[model samples]
Target: MTHVMACIDYSQSSLAVCDYAAWAAQKLGAPLTLLHVLDEEKYPAAADLSGNIGLGSREHLLEELATLDAQRARLALEQGQHTLEKARERTVVSGAAFPELKQRHGHLVESLSELEAEIRLLVIGRVGENSNRGAQSLGSQIEAVVRTIHRPILITASSYRRPEKVMVAFDGSPTAYKTVQMFAASQLCEGLPIHLVMVGADLEDNREALEKARSMLISSGFEVHAEIRQGDVEAALHVYQSEHGIDLLVMGAYGHSRIRQFLVGSTTTTMLRTATMPVLLLR
Candidate 1:
């Protein structure tokens, strides 16, 4: 919880992650750490040889397999190091303070959890290394990371855009209120105008909740545009974004099992998959 951490991989978007992490570090006045994990299952250091072996030649085959696996693991480590170096250089060029480079050999979610206490905010790519160029397909670890890490996560697009106009997708829940408060206090979007949007029936309760959140932001010295849109949640938000040219989308993310299931439904995953702009999710 001392610095901002950005997850980097072999994807081209990893550069954008570095830039975003640098920008966030500048704003929050925290150190920046670039994390690259070499998943053991994906890049094993040694081949499994627990199966029954018959003859002396089986030992030779096992040794060959183990050597090949070790070479693969070494290659993965080298690639990760190169990626981290590039990210660090980019961060320096972006005019932020130098960043700490961290490389691990394990699952991404597990690594993130291990470093959770030292991260104030987590920045990651919308799509993992396996996804295509477009941010249309989500990375495999997106849901798992969302479910495990109880911190602010900024999921970026294929590219980076310095956020100018910020929007918060409010659902009128306690999580939503916490998001507003955290956004206001963090100074992450200190000078940007905020659009507080809720997509649903504009009932009395919704209106009051929206108004309250609006006032809170206003009191924090932000220009607030609060409104309720009708239609599908993702569709409505996209329309509003297109109409106003929102640079970044913000939303509350809860890590509880039930809450995470709901977020996977149409909120976090939908926006991450569809929204072209960077999305900042807070828990």
Candidate 2:
């Protein structure tokens, strides 16, 4: 149950996932696993090809189709194994030692659901092999996992480097506090500079909550810099992240502010599209 599970599909996002998962494996003190799922729906081995034949179709053609289906399934299995081995090698080189490899045959969401209990931190790519890029291209499987899975998800972009500074999009809600506490408990970002930015109307209450959150991190041995910004929450964070050299962004999956808008629906995709840095969405 302490696996730093990384979902890889050999997409452009996959290499980044492996690297981030390796970093997580070191910080979390857990084994790294490169998980590849041969989605049957997308790569069917025995799709029903018997009934939809043309009126003058040859029976031998149906036989040939069946043979091709079997070949496709076999090829998918072989490719999955090859990809897993390559990913494992990449992860180990990134920093993790002796990473494990796993291959499952099913839908992505269902496969993850079965492995939910075993995952301490789940690292996944923002887009899959089917999606072109991360901008407004949040894959359906990612959305399902973010919504249904009961764990922290570290969503990786197509490209990422080791993060030097970390930023938490704080709003002073219960989830926001939990996000801080979760970050404190894990050594994932240990010793890195922290920017606790809250975007909203500059009310005294917001200031108070922000200070409280900062104190918690300070007590946990983190260098903390807390502040309140105006304008859109997601937009402000992106600006601050870029200006401050923040390479990682952390936030609660559910919150009261418009920040939550970036976690679900079309808005989420559009907001995260330009965000090339990885986002740690707390459960």
TM-score per candidate, chains pooled: 0.92, 0.91
lDDT of 1: 0.86
Please provide, for model 1 over 1-283, each residue's C-alpha lDDT reduced to its tens digit, 9 standing for 90 to 100.
3889999998878888988999999998899999999989989878667474766658767878889989999999999999899889999999879899999998899999999999999999988787754666677778889889998999987888899999888877787888889988878998899999988898999899899999989999999999999998888999999999999999877533333554556556677778899888887
In model 2, the runs with Cα more than 4 Å from the true position are 47-60, 134-136, 260-270
Over 203-250, each residue of candidate 2 has an lDDT whose tens digit, in order, gives 999999999999999999999999899997568878998789888988
For TM-score, the strongest prediction is 1
- Model 2: how far residue 37 lies from native, Å: 0.7
